[model samples]
Target chain A: MKVLVTVKEVAEVDDEFQISGLDVDDGSLEYDLNEWDDYAVEEAVQLSEADDDVEVVTVTIGPERAEETIRMALAKGADRAVRVWDDNLADAGFLDVDTKAALLAAVAEAEAPDIVFSGVQAGDDANGATGVALAERLGFEWAAVVNDFELDRDADVASVRRELEGGVEELTDVELPAVFTIQTGINEPRYASLRGIRQAQRKELEVRTIDDVGLDESVLESPVDRTDMYEPASEGDATYWEGSPEETAGELAAFLRDEGVVSS
Target chain B: MSVLAVAEHRRGEVRDVSYELVTAGRRLADGLGGELNLLVVGGDVDGFAEDLNRDGVDTVYTVDDGEEFNHGIHAAAIERLHADLEPTALVAPNSVDGLDYAPAVAQRLDVPLVTDVIDFEVDGGGIEVTREQYGGKVETTYQVDADQYAVTVRPAEWPQAEDRGDAAVEPIDVDVGGESGTTVNGFEEVGGGDVDITEADVLVSIGRGIEEAENLPLVEELADTLGATLSSSRPIVDNEWLPKNRQVGQSGKVVTPDVYIAIGISGAVQHVAGMKGADTIVAINTDPNAPIYDIADYGIVDDLFDVVPALIEEFGGDPPEV
Candidate 1:
């Protein structure tokens, strides 16, 4: 089995993002493989390890700097990497949801992986739509917010355990060539090794562009627009009730009732 | 100029978020000095449309197709509507389905797509949207630069509109061509047996401060007494003490209940980002300076072990057996 993992370079999750002073186009902030995507890549690596014939390929879209993110995946044990470079991609305002779906569709067309994996959502947008869209585009089965997975190639089915509203829901006998969008609690991602990092420098990386995938730039439409960016005003000082556990609970319940948040 | 709000439903029943989207659309339409039109699409959605029309919609377009939701069908339907109605803006809830389809519609229309909008207003000539960034640490406002804009309104951010006596219902025939490339072979519900936290008016969210899985029952007891639901921060879910659906954070479900009770949660920005919209927030933690208190309406600086049991007892709820 072969797996294709989609990764994106996003603003470092730990960075203090400033809306007023920063340029939206200029890549001024630190970048890393989306935190959730790392888990997807790790899942792919685990699959490959579980099956010797399994191959894991990592793919990402960004400028040349995005290669670093792909390299991080390689260092984490993906067999190879692909970097779809377009320096103006982000500035083109082409990062909307459908463009991403189309881009992944194009990648799926070229790679033909048996299984596709991605984090439920990206750190930048945190919309959690790509995997579902990609699955829809590829006409493959899909499950979202999955924490556990077991694939049976012979049966052409994948059993997934996903987090739903109340308890864990088990999806058994799902068809294969499916897409799974992993949730944050799926697994703890492993750190890259120094040896792996050194070897990643020599790993083969297949680079492609929008044209390479037969997608014309004209087909890309961005329905959303940004008029201006400004910082949100600070909320007023929060009220605090300090007391013994019993007293505090009593006061808190009373306050909730007073605020109409709870019925008396 | 008119605004079009997309209505989402399952099994011919409208989701609560649809009402919220309509309410948001009415506000934006009013701001733009236009009328609010609602677009309902689904299989056997006529009854759903009739139910939706009670909200006093100026125009209600119903597309009753027997097919379940597909991105291609939804996109094509939206595109067809855009061509005919020429709405100034299109709005939907920032839900899983909306995120999947809205971007496709935006890409098809060549317009800007603003998502996770907490607030929106029409300014001089464009739409201004406010959204949270950096996992809720910063709130950023954007002014859209497109003639036709698409936005996904965050749930709970806007109040549902009051139902009007009646509304004009129009049957809209949309040519949703054959499946674009995807088909819903089947639909399986996520975790079974758990209540939807989004629908819960009161949520008792536990954090690492709970210490052990056994202590969760104490929180559950309080929730039961208050007729509330039990939820958790990411760490509790990560530790497998609670299901992921109950996880409240950027990576989990975003809930804005009437009342939110946080026990032993240190309150990371990611977690706070998801729940800051709640009407009233109460935090109980040993640390007086926990970040959860920064946004909490009431703070209890005490050990949860002492607090939760007392809460259960005071509320006439059975305390968990130690």
Candidate 2:
């Protein structure tokens, strides 16, 4: 069986940052593997480790700079990697859900993996829609916010637990040829060891353009356009305690005592 | 140019987002000069439809299906409803199940989808959605230039519709029984442990700012000094530094303590959802722009490492050496 994991390298903005046109200034941004996708990669890799004939392949839609993030996934245990990017995409200011699902659908059609894994949402956009949209495009089954699962190879079913709000988990069983959007805290994602990191350098990392993935510039067309980006005007009316640590702490202590929730 | 809003339910009760979708749908419908139609797919459809008929709703459509949410059934039912109604826009909750089916429905209909929209406006037959990015540090607006679109509104952003309306309750038969790719077995309530943080009057919560598992003692000492229960944001529980029972967020326990002292917590939307009801909220963090400040009644903008020790000293307690 083959598993395809969708990985993304998302940008984390600094506490104090500047906005440059449509996005955060490059100088104030830090790039890393998405926290949620890390869990998805580990889920796929663990599946590969538990079974005899399971093969893990990761697919990413990012620029060449994302190779570092892709390599991190490879080091964690993915057998190989496929990256889809080109100039047309780099110029596309905002890629909406349809555009992204179409791009991923093109790759999924070519690879045709038995199972697909993606993060519940990206840390940046947080759309939380691409995987289910991709599944719909491929006519495959899907489950979202899946935190735990037991895959039955023989029956070709995955008994999964979808984490809901307020500490409730819905149990469900999805048929094979399905997509599972893995949630965080599902499993402990292991760190890439020294040997794994060295081995990742030699792993096959294939780069393909939009056309190479059997698509053209038309895939970049979307109805959604990002108009503006800015730090939201602060709605805070908080009474700030401004002083040295001792003075501010004293203020908080006095307030807590006045409220009778704390005693000194 | 009507708006269709779908309601969600679990077990036997309709979720709060269902009512919130009504508020969003009514706003868009008013802007577009059309009607606002509501939908309840499964699990007590009649009852849910009655509850969802808010002041501005014109029609409530109910499709009686299973007792629980199965994405396969939900996706099929919603797609069929959209095709029949042909509304100018479709609105759903950005809940876990909403993420499951809204995207699939939008994909099948080939409409532009914008998820987790905190605010939106309809103008000249087009829509612009406002959403947060970089973990709510910044907000971005996007214009969707389409005749029809789908959007999921973030939960708790809009107030729940409480006033009942005089809308026509209609039962619509949607054929979703043949949809069998997935089956929802049942639901399980997790996070049962030694401590029930919900019962506490005071909660000292830590977040990613705590830095490492070894540094947890710093916050433990503060909680002890205040004689408060210990809780945390999702990351601390995700990191396994604390047990799942101690987690305070959307997926964790909803805590309404008398005093919620948030140390080093950035107050992500999920984290805020769990603790925003506290009577008094105090934040201690170095970042002045953290979302936690928006809801905080009192705040100290300083490194937690410095302020925590001082707070312990003010309470006449020795800070633990981490």
Candidate 3:
């Protein structure tokens, strides 16, 4: 079984973001593989480790810096890497969703992977729309927020567990050649081993362009309006509740009741 | 030509967020110079749809089937409806179920999809949607360049319209026959003893500032006395002081109530993003400069220990002693 996983380079989750005076490209910030995409790569690697015939390939779209992200995935145990590099992609603004979807669709058509994996949502834009769109373009069945999965190559079916508001739903016997968007907490992602890092340095990575994949720039959707982007305003003064446990509890209860939070 | 809104229901009750989506859809439809039609899908959900017949909705399309909610089935039903009705726009609630099906429906129809839209308006030949990004530290606006667009309205962001009217209910015979790519084998409801925070009119959320897990009894006592549902930031849930079901943040639940009281919370962007939509926000952090205060309507610069008891005394409410 072959698996194709999509990874994205995004602003680091922990970095403090600052608006660069209305200039999108002028913004200087540290970057890393999107937090959720790490889970996608992790799931793909685990599937490969479980099956001898399974091969995991990672794909991303960005400038040359994005290669580092692909390298990180390769180190984590992807069999190979693909970078869809384009200089126009930097100022590309909002078109990444459609562009990436088109790229993934093209790749899937060429390789015909048995399964495709993506993060439930990207950490940077957090759109959570691309995976389903890509799946639809490729005409594959998809399950979103999937936490558990079991593949039956013989039966051509996959059983998956999806997370809901309060519980888990066990999805039984879904057809394969499908896409699954992995939610966080689905599995604990393993650290890249030293041996894996060395092997990643020697692995083959293929770079493809829009023209090479028979994709047109006309399909890209541009942002209609550029709204003012700003940091969210802060709120409140910190109030500390203190005293003996009994005293604090008594006081807190009274406060809630008085504030009309509780029925008095 | 008008917009179509999907109302979500379970067990004969309409979810609160469904009303919010209708309110937003009504506004968008009006802005587009079109009427709004509400669509409800579920078994025996006509009662739920009837209750949502407010001013903005021109008609209600009810598709009631005994089948449990399945993503593939729902998508197919919606695809058929979209082709038949030819709505200019489609709106869904950004709940777990809505997120599961909305994108698929949009994809099946080859339309653009936007999820978690906090604010939206109809632009020239497109829809502009503003959503929180980077864990709510920054807000980004997106415009879908498609003739027909679909969006999921974030819960609690828009006010639920209360225009009372008995809308004409149109029963649509949908062929619920489809190969379900997935089946629900079982379900386990979390926090059965506690009230759902999403339905709470008032919420008091705690953070790491609570100091210790043993001290949660203080917050719990307050919640008990006030009849307020207790919620917390992700860290508190991570620390096991509260159940994961009670965590309120970007990664957890987004809540909007009449009043939201932040007790001892430092207000990380993730936590603030969830409650910033409350009508009246009150912050009770010991640090006067905590981020939670920026959006708070009332700020207490003193220690919660000093202020909370004073507030109780002022209101003449007695606390329950353990």
Candidate 4:
């Protein structure tokens, strides 16, 4: 069995930053492996470790800078990596959900993995749609926000617990050849070991363009255009407690007391 | 041209977002000078359709299907409905269940999809959606340059339409029981542990700002000093530094404590959803522009390491050394 984990290198903005135009300034943006994908990678790796002949491959749609982030996944446990990037994708103003799914669908078709895992959502775009959309494109079954699951190889079913809103977990069984969007808290993602890091340097990190992935530049054509970006106007009517930490603490203490929730 | 919004439900009751979707769909339909249609599938469709007949709703389409939400069934039903109606806009919730099927519907329909939309406008030829990115640090507007598109509205962004209207209730029986690849066994209630954060009057919620598990004692002492319960944002629970029961977020518990003190938390939209109803909110963080301050009644823009300890001292409790 093979598991393909889709990972993304998401951009996290600095505490104080500048929006140059349609995006935050490059100096203000820091890229890291998406938080949710870390869990997905761990889930795939754990599956590979427990079972024989389970090859874990990582796939990402990012530029060259993201290879560093992809390596983090490889250093943990993925057997190899595939990265799809081209000049067209970088120039593409905004990639909407459809465009992303189409690009990923092309790769999944070629790989033909038994199972696909994607983060529930990226920390940056937070569309939370790519995985299921890709499943739709591939004609595969899917489950979203999956926090726990047990795969039955003989029956070709996965008994999963999907974390719903407000403390509810929906228990579901999805057939094989499926996509499961891994949610946070599903498992503890391990830190890359020193030995694994050295091995990752020698692993196959194949880079592909749109053409290489059997996709044309037309795949980059998106109907969505990012028009404007700005800091949201502060809705805070919060009274600032200005002073040293001690003085602000005193003000908070007094306020808590005044509210009668706390007593001095 | 009309606008269609899918009503969401779980277990036996309709979700609040279903009504909010009506309110959102009404706005889009009004902008396009068209009709507003609501779609309810599975689990008390008739009752859901009746409750969804808001003041501005023009029609309610019910598909009597399974007892609970099945994404495969939903995707098939919605795809057929979209084809038959050809609505200008397909609006659904950005909730967990919505994510399960909305993307599939959009993909099958080959229409552009924008999720977690906070605000939108239909003008001239296209729709413009406003959504937050980079963890609510900034808002970006996207122009969907298409006549037909799909969007999932963020919960609680729009007020629910309460005034009842006599919308035409049409039951559309689409064949959706062909082959569902997934089966929902049942639902289990998680996060039931020792302390129920929902019952607390005061909550001192620590987030990623607590730094490490060892530093948790610092905030625990603060919660102890003020006779408050200790709760946390999702990261604390994800890290296993705190129990799942102590998590305050959309997935965990909706806490309406008298006072919610957010420490070192940037206040993601999900986290804010759980505690925004607090009578008084206080935020302590180093970042002056954290989203938590936007909703807080009082704020201290300082390092939590310094302010938390001082606050503990102000309450006449010795701060624990991390």
| Strongest candidate by lDDT | 4
TM-score of each: 0.72, 0.98, 0.78, 0.99
Worst 10 residues of 4 chain B by lDDT: B172-181
lDDT of 1: 0.74
TM-score of chain B of each: 0.74, 0.97, 0.72, 0.98
Off by over 4 Å in 3: A13-17, A21-27, A166-173, A223-227, A232-264, B144-146, B176-178, B190-322
Per-residue lDDT value at A109 in model 2: 91
* Model 2 Cα lDDT, one tens digit per residue, B197-268: 999999999999999999999889989999999999988888888999999989999999999999999999
Q: Write the per-residue lDDT of candidate 3 for residues A243-263, one digit (tens) a residue.
A: 543455455556555666655
Clashing pairs in 4: none
> For each candidate, C-alpha RMSD in Å?
6.6, 1.1, 6.6, 0.9
- The sequence of per-residue lDDT tens digits that candidate 1 reaches over residues B97-210 is 676577556656756677788897788778878876544544566777677888888866677775863768888777876544334444555433456788888998999888
CAPRI grade of model 3: acceptable
Ranking by TM-score: 4, 2, 3, 1
Query: In model 3, what lDDT does residue B191 have?
Result: 37
Where model 1 places Cα greater than 4 Å from the true spot, the runs are: A12-20, A23-32, A50-53, A62-69, A84-115, A129-180, A186-202, A205-231, A241-264, B67-73, B179-204, B208-231, B243-280, B284-295, B299-322
Report the candidate with higher lDDT, 3 versus 4. Answer: 4
- Candidate 2 per-residue lDDT, tens place, A71-98, comes to 9999999999999998888888678888
